[model samples]
Target: MPTHYVYLGLGSNVEREIHIDMALSMLEEHIDPLRRSPIYESASIDPRQSPFYNLVVGGSTDLSLAELNAWIKDIELLHGRTSSTQRFIPLDIDILLFDDLAGLHEGIELPRAEILDRAFVLYPLQQLAPHLKHPGLGISFAELWRQLQPGPQLSSVRYPFGVSSFALTVQAGRFPLPGDPCQLAAI
Candidate 1:
């Protein structure tokens, strides 16, 4: 079986921390040796809801795109996510990018548009794969991040469960931290 590189975006507002950890656990069980980006907390796009915590996780999988996507959606459902419950999401997982494939497949768009339109998605993606080129745009994530205007909503914070070592590079000053960056040395 050939493995394809996959990047997934995770977010939650209700039971934010716990849900994120649960999702990570599920990912580890499903995708070995997951590489994660540092967690980013941001105000909900929906003003009425609580703030959301977001991050990206990457891994190589032998599963087909549709199969992997369905598996992730199942994981979210297992964690209490429901399309019927719009106000609070216990776990939200999105297939952000899949092996440089473009166009629509299995009813999901490749290189999800949100990756460029939303800061919550882009920031963590840039952190995880800075040099990766957008299949559609053909520009590096790091360059896309640089061209984007900074927003006040997203900030780097330490999660109690900790992040992957690759995420730690941010603390070493490789990337500029958002507002009030966490003092990682103390953690």
Candidate 2:
């Protein structure tokens, strides 16, 4: 099958660690044609849940946008996620970008602003595809890193779980999400 580039955002709070594990395993088993983004850990925004473990994954696949999204929704359900309960959950997966405005649904959006706002998503994305320009923002990952106020402190924090040794070369400023049209202009 021909492949199209796609970006996915991942998060877990309810049973943070275990949910992430299940999500990853499900991805590998069902979301084939995948390459994972760097994993990031961050505090949960919802008061009802624990801290979240977040990350983005990049890859190309032949599945139609809706088809792929449906599969993901199924995975979320298996992990105990529900559309009605949004405060916090064991797992939350979103389709960040799908091949150049190709996959957006009637209500669905792309290059989620949340990706840029959260350090977890940006840092890991820098590791996985730093050179890839944001669909909306013209700035590269290296450029965004340079623009960040203090820059990501990759050296200071250590993750309890295993991490890939993918190092990003950041240049130090905050960056916009790839799919955001405003951010795409940076490219």
Candidate 3:
């Protein structure tokens, strides 16, 4: 089996920590040598009641794009996520990149458009794979991150659970949530 490098974006607002931890655990089980960016707390994109915890995970997988998509969907549903539920998102996961693949495949847009537009997505992705080129844009993720306009407020959070390969550090100081100006570039 051939392995392809894959990056996944994860976020949660409801029981933020618990949901993110759950997703990470599931991903670790499915993907090997998982590399995760430090967790970040950001305001929800949609006007919502709670803030969200966001991060990006990268690893190598032998599964095809469609298989991986289905696997992630199943993990979300297993964690109580449903398309019909709107008010609170328990967990949300998106495929950000798949070995430089472009165009549409398995009903997903390659190098997810959000990566170019959202600070939450771009920052963590750059943290994990700065030199990797965006399949559609042909620019490195780090450069794309530098070019994005102001986006949602994001603050680094000390994720409690430890994945063996990742180091978790707690930053001292309370970051004001939402409506406060916090940019990853400054961190």
lDDT of each: 0.84, 0.65, 0.82
TM-score of each: 0.84, 0.71, 0.84
Residue pairs in clash, model 3: none
Off by over 4 Å in 3: 161-187
lDDT of 2 by residue, 8-95 (tens): 8888767676887777777775455667755555666555656676777777777777777888899999988887467767788888
Least accurate stretch of 10 residues (summed lDDT) in model 1?
Answer: 178-187
**For residues 98-127, what per-residue lDDT tens digits would candidate 1 score against the true structure?**
999999988989989988878999888998
TM-score of 1: 0.84
Give candidate 1 misplaced runs (Cα > 4 Å): 161-182, 185-187
Q: Write the per-residue lDDT of candidate 3 for residues 102-179, one digit (tens) a residue.
A: 988878889798998998899999998899888887899999988999998898785564421122111324454556
Q: Flag regions of model 2 displaced more than 4 Å.
A: 102-106, 149-187
lDDT of 2 at 68: 79
Span of ten consecutive residues with least summed lDDT in model 3: 163-172
Per-candidate RMSD, Å? 5.7, 11.0, 6.7
Decreasing lDDT order of the candidates: 1, 3, 2
